[model samples]
Structure formats: structure tokens, C-alpha cells
Target: MKLGTLVKPLLITGLIIAGPAMAAPSAQQVLAASPVDDIVERYPAMMSEGIREGLKRSPQLPPMVADTIGYVVSNSFRAADIEQQIVKNLERDLSGKQLEAVEGWYKTPVARKISAVEIAASDPAAWQQMQAKAAELGKKYKGTDRARMFERFDRAARATESAVDTTIAVQLGLATAMAAFSPDSANYDELKRKIENQRNAIRGVVEQQVYDSYLHTYEKISMQEMGLYIDFLESGPGSAFSKTVTQSIQQAITDPIESIGNQMARFLAPQK
Candidate 1:
């Protein structure tokens, strides 16, 4: 037939064929679409509050020692530093389609609502409220379908897993700080093993804490909203994004602590 008609068809076919080769969302674009950066930005302050509470519980902990640990944690778990590392890891791990899908989901209305709740819950005051009302909330949700659904959501979101990783990271930071004052510093492996040996115990605590926190955080979010969020998390791209972010966060926090023992030791050392 006509030359113009033939060229139009060819152009359409070429575009269709090239669609899959289009550039994926950049790491910053994906992060910007998600709540990850916001959540990470609050980490240092949250950690400081956690340490303060923990120190309160540890009446035996010397003030100087507590101060040292605080200093180390504050310096070591910088939000910008962690976010930069997470971007690097996500860049390496996420596929173009996966990143695009994750960005799409995070941009949704439901995700925005849930993300707001999560960000608010990340606050120290929110944590304190959750802790204070944990027992009451646990009883209210117990034996209900809501609780069951929450379990599924938690599993999909890797909530407990991430919490455990955070617990381990905090412990590792403390150990690294303590090592600074010790005569013989434990190597990374030894410190890791020592921390990991308590993983089961740590998981038990984090599991309950995560559950309670979820209940409190999502209390305002309707069941339908939570269900939609869960569906996203269970999807292939969602699962991958959840897993990648969790691992990236763990690495960002731990990588510095792994070698921080030496630096902290030197910093805490007496002037020569």
C-alpha cells in the first residue's frame, strides 16, 4: 500500500519492541517515591532515644560509658551516610522493572497514608506510647482476624526481620563502643558471633515489639487500606523492594560498626 502507512506501522512496532529497554527509575527517583529516606532520616534521633531509655534501664551502666556509647552511635549511624549506602545497594540489586514497580506502588494514595503512619510511629514519643499501651493493644487484637492479617502483613513487610536486624545493629554498636575501652578488642567475627548467638532471644523480643508497634501504628488505618498495603508487599516487586531495603539498611548501619571499634578506641584513648 502507501509508503507512509508502512513507515507508521514500522515505527509503532519499533517503539513497542524498545519499550522494555527504556531506562529504569534511578535510585534517587525510587527512594524519593518511597518513605525510606524519611524513615532513615529519623533513625539517629530514634536511636538516641532508644539508647537513653536503655541506659535508664541499666542502672549499673556508668555515665561515662553510656556517654561513650551515645557518642559512637550518634557518629556511626548518620542518616545521610546510611541513605547513601542504601542507594548504592539498591542500585546494584534492583532491576529496572522492579524499581519502576516499587516507585509506582509507593506513589499510590494508600501507600502514602500507610507511609505517614509509619513515619509518625517512628518518632520517640510514638514509641513510648506504643510501649505504654502494648499490653492493652495486644489484648484487643488477640484472636481476631485483624491480628491474623497483621501477621501476614508483618511477614510480607519483613517487619520482624528488619526489627531484629536493627536490634543486632544497635547491639553491635554498643559492643563496638565497649571494645574501645577493652584491653583486647574483639574482631568483627567474634563480635558478630557473640551478637548472633543471642539472635533467637532477640527475635522473640523484636517479634512482640514489632507486633505491638504495628497494631498501634496502623490502628487508624482501615482494614481495607491495610489489605491493599499487604497485597502490594506480597507482590513480586514489592517483596524484592522490601527485602532489598531491609538488607541495605542493615548493611549501612553495620558496615561502619564493623571497623568502628578501632576508630572509637583511638578517639576514646588518653592523649599521648
Candidate 2:
């Protein structure tokens, strides 16, 4: 899941034991202990909301076509499916030590506190609040040490990078949804190139948005607490977990997107 969710971004579950010893924690166990599960559960709605807004700002399509795109996207991006993918990837990609480290870290008081704030920030409602208080946040933390710390946290979390990846995914989904309508013009490779070209511009907007989100999300969190969280994220295990989740989400999101055009085409086809 992306934090600060689709407008922003998103855990773990279960264990087996034998005799007196706990079995090596499965990916499911790690996930149950992590924030990914809760945060990811909110993704379908966040993504739908984000894309709906994006579509509104885009060149106008007929209401029926727009609705079709929304429906296709909504169905294609399922939270359960994404969570399952993350769990599977975690089991396959992360070593036993890495998994144990992640699970342990997430169960920490500091990690829990940070996770709670992050989960809260993933709500679409939170995005609304962030916008409403944007000015207040900017005035209060614009140049302070806390603001700088938030910047460090953002980098540590790769929040801007995740947001950028999400933006590109959404754009690619849009192009895919419209491809059937203009296959000749909607060359996927060409569209991908165009999206790549806008990377720097996208980064500028996303970086500020991510920073603002950090300010808003961590408003109650102390600078010291933020510093500790940043340090963990920069640590080996924490970095591994962050990358794992990021890659998992990217794959889950992009995998479905590839075939969405065909789905949209079928959905928009005339009833026989």
C-alpha cells in the first residue's frame, strides 16, 4: 500500500507452534503483526476515490465511458487480492531473519504508534482533512526543525517515490481503460514514455504533497519519536520491509492494470 494513501497509501497475521518452541513465523504471521493488512484493506476505496478525481480533471469522456472506467478499476484492484500478493511475495522474497525482524519491529511500541498514524493517514477522509488544514500546517512547520525531520522521515519511508509510482500506475490504468476506444492512438509503449518524461514534474508535486501529509499525519507525534522511526526505516530490516511492501504493492497494482483494457472493452461491448 502507498501511505498518505491513493490520495495517500497501507499488514500481517498467524503463527504455528510445536512442542515448547514457536515455529518460524510465516509470512501471514509477520503480516498480521505489521500495519500492511489494515492499511491495505483501505486501498480499494482510496484508489477508487483517487482515480475518480483524476478522471474528473482529465479530458471529458461520456458519462457512460467514465463510469465504465471506474467500474473496471474498482473491480480490478481488490484489497484482498493485493494483500494476498504481499503475503505471497513476503514469503518468497524475504529471508526468515528478515521476516522475524519485521514482525518484531512492528510489534514495538514505537512502530505501533507510527503504524497507527500511518493507517489513519490512509483514510480518504484524512486526505480531506489534510487539504483543509494545509495552510495551517505550512505556517506552523514550514521552516522548523520538526519540518526538516519530517523531510528526513519522508525520504526514509520513500513516501514520495511510492506516491510517484502510484501516480504512474494510475495514469497507466487510465491509458489502458481508454485504449479500446482508440487502440491506434493509445500505444502503451508510447504512453509509458510520456509518463516517464513527466517523472521530474510528478516528483515536484508529489514531494510537497507527501511532506504535507507527513506534517499532518505526524502532528501529534514528537520530533524524537519521528527521529526514532526514521532511524528504524533506515536500518537494514526496516529498509527491507519497506522495500518488500513497496514492491509488493507495485506488482499488485500494476499486474491487474495490464489487462484492464480488455475488461473495459468487454464491459462496454453491446449486449448480444
Which residue segments of model 2 deviate by more than 4 Å? 1-22, 179-184, 265-272
CA RMSD of all predictions: 3.7, 12.0
Query: Evaluated with TM-score, which candidate comes out highest?
Result: 2
Q: What's the lDDT for candidate 1? A: 0.81
TM-score of each: 0.83, 0.84
| Local accuracy of candidate 2 as per-residue lDDT tens digits, 167-207 | 88788877665555563655677778888899999899988
| lDDT for predicted candidate 2 compared with the true structure | 0.79
Please give, for residues 114-147, the per-residue lDDT of candidate 1 as tens digits. 9989888887777778889999999998988779
The 0-to-1 C-alpha lDDT of every candidate, in the order given, reads 0.81, 0.79
